[model samples]
Target: MSTLDQSRYLATPIPGPRSQELIDRKAAAVSRGIGNTMPVYAARAFGGIVEDVDGNRLIDLGSGIAVTTIGNSSPRVVDAVRRQAAEFTHTCFMITPYEGYVAVAEHLNRLTPGTGEKRSALFNSGSEAVENAIKIARSYTGKSAVVSFDHAYHGRTNLTMALTAKSMPYKHGFGPFAPEIYRAPLSYPFRDGEFGKEIATDGALAAKRALTVIDKQVGADNLAAVLIEPIQGEGGFIVPADGFLPALQGWCRDNNVVFIADEVQTGFARTGAMFACEHEGIEPDLIVTAKGIADGLPLSAVTGRAEIMDAPHVSGLGGTYGGNPIACAAALATIETIEADGLVERAREIETLMKDRLGRLQAEDDRIGDVRGRGAMIAMEFVKPGTLEPDAELTRALCAGCHAAGVIVLSCGTFGNVVRFLPPLTISDDLLVEGLDVLELVLKDL
Candidate 1:
């Protein structure tokens, strides 16, 4: 829907005149808690590029933190939203009910990774879905304790703050977090290498290490859920070791624990698979999805086993704007576009291209500690030239250089040493390679 060209073009400097003016106003008006990665304010966006207020067509590698998977202003989503708004925006799905909400729940139940009888409840965001899932697990199993892994980024809510691993920025001084939330070790191959070779190679061993701690600290009998991101997002694009996810799922199955996959960042074909759990053949009892569900619209869901989801009583799970009609319409259209466009396969192709490119770069540079992730959701972890020590300096420099060159790259990780790349699946081959070209130049300069 953008009028500007699809490729990268900078008519002015990164922030430009108008963006600088907006930035000045934002500082005066907006809260400091919210931050933006791209320096310029967006005027329009389509496919893989964002046109800033100063008439700069910049490559959007971040994809609005993996939210705009189907692409910004997708025609299908736009038309659906327009049509739904023309009729009515909301009648409260909880009070009056609507076909759109039911249809979305049906789609999630069918498409999610499982053949069991399933049900879904829609929410306004990933955080809400997560909190509700935990509540459902507790109600069904009558357990109060929960286990979360290291390097997990759930959300900013009070309960999720305790669930998250990072301290500063996400959970700094968020005093006296929720009770009975426990932290466990993750199967981080790159970091585990420094611990021991056997642990690095065998994911089951790492799971055992965590499970033992869980047994001693939080006892599986009292545990309500084992919530985790299949691929850790804000902590870094960390893909666990080979058997990591499956091992944890197996233990959760043996116990009465609800294994919840927080697929907020990795769902909706953002990863090569339709869902990241499919890659490892791990079926979660409950799956929390958002970010990419309705193109750019705000919608989220907690889909799970029917018995588990049905545990809550009537009037238990909902909000004023949960499953808004407009967002539901947008979600249905987004799924249609994804299926019709063969985006899942496109993600695999992107993985082949990006991993191959970054793999070669890693071979050449010692500072590039690891290049990991699935589909278009790839990341590079920076470290000291000859050691495992995190090099956050290099990561920040790389991000700044990319922004200066009109390519929007994002930084992440607990140690602040990861540079993630999440280009829209609809991006042209030439444009994708051109973005990589910008990244290479940034690396070379750094």
Candidate 2:
């Protein structure tokens, strides 16, 4: 048997004794608006496992919403962060530009999907990166209309919310959104209904539909850019058809529309490629990336053509906390770690392993409506057997079961029926497979 740690508290259930004490304190002291998935409190995490305050060791499949792709407490990242902190933590880049920040930007310009005269500006979050991308697009194109796809999750900021599609939680009670943002259909093959077979054609159709809307409603001349998640993240990890992205890129090129690939969740080898757009042979005009950028530091960036990135007036794009030195150091170290450890190849290995396990589960159970994703960023959509209808209840149950079995899993999707797995790329194969086995057992119960 694999010697992976499967320690479970025989004393009490998870949120056991010590964690429950923390939860009680949290409910009284902290904001109730923020939700807890498993009601477990973490003490520390490394590689794939998060040891909660209760001393329950749970395999981390979520990777803290895919932020810690390299791993939790990676030696290089930790040391870099510590060293940077020792030197200085907060010398705002705008006030005094630092070498680490400049290095990170340069690295991003080189690493992001595009080649040829690229530039990058770092920000604090995915939303900020996205906001800057739009700013650049609008400033460069001299347009007001920005188009995004349905079921897309850009971020929580006002402009991003306007760009986002899901109405319930994202848009609910936050109306009077930013103007000139338009919504288009994403290629959700599993839920395409009538349009499933023509996904390629549908991509063109979605573009044409948006173009028609722009022509009639917003006007092509008034449109700034069309931003899309290369692999739609919180929106169900929807991978578009083979020709879809390329066709959309063609449309954008022909129409003079800036094609923005939101690599916030798919960048940094979380997907098989360094960037998801690379999978489709696409070189987007602007690429927004965050999430996995700096291991766990709050860093993000927009890298694009030099002319466009420089279009905005000097001092137009920046924030007080944007590209803090510590985060920059973490980012530099993360990049070095990715290359030095060959995490990109590791991501591919993870994809194969996950697909093999999840595919087998899918084959055995029809509740798994769809088992789809690229690389380690895999997800399975649960649905009522023989139907496309979402089974969020079963998804919840599966996640709970996995947690009980000492594995942490996360549920996503507009309908909350998807269980996405984003284990640290540095996770041991033994631990990863154990987590998969636990998940399989959970699914069987479901």
Per-residue lDDT tens digits for candidate 1, residues 339-397, read: 99999999999999999999999999999999999998999999999999999998998
lDDT of each: 0.93, 0.86
Off by over 4 Å in 2: 1-11, 200-217
For 1-446, candidate 2 gives per-residue lDDT tens digits of 12324443323587698888888999899997678888888877877777777667788889999999998877899899989999998978889788998899889888887668999999999998999999999999988899888789999899999988888777899888999898766667788755556643466655554456556766667788989998988888888766667877887788778999999999999997888898878999999999899999899999999998999999998999999999999999999999999999999999999998889988989988888999999999998999988999998988888887778888889999999999889888888898888888777765
What lDDT score is found at residue 182 in candidate 2? 80
Kindly give the number of clashing pairs for every candidate.
Answer: 1, 1
Q: Candidate 1 has which clashing residue pairs, if any?
A: 235-413
* True-structure Cα RMSD, model 1: 0.8
lDDT of model 1, residue 169 = 91
Model 1 TM-score is 0.99
Reference-based lDDT, residue 37, model 1: 76
lDDT (Cα, 0-100) at 112 in candidate 2: 81
**Window of ten residues with lowest summed lDDT in model 1:** 1-10
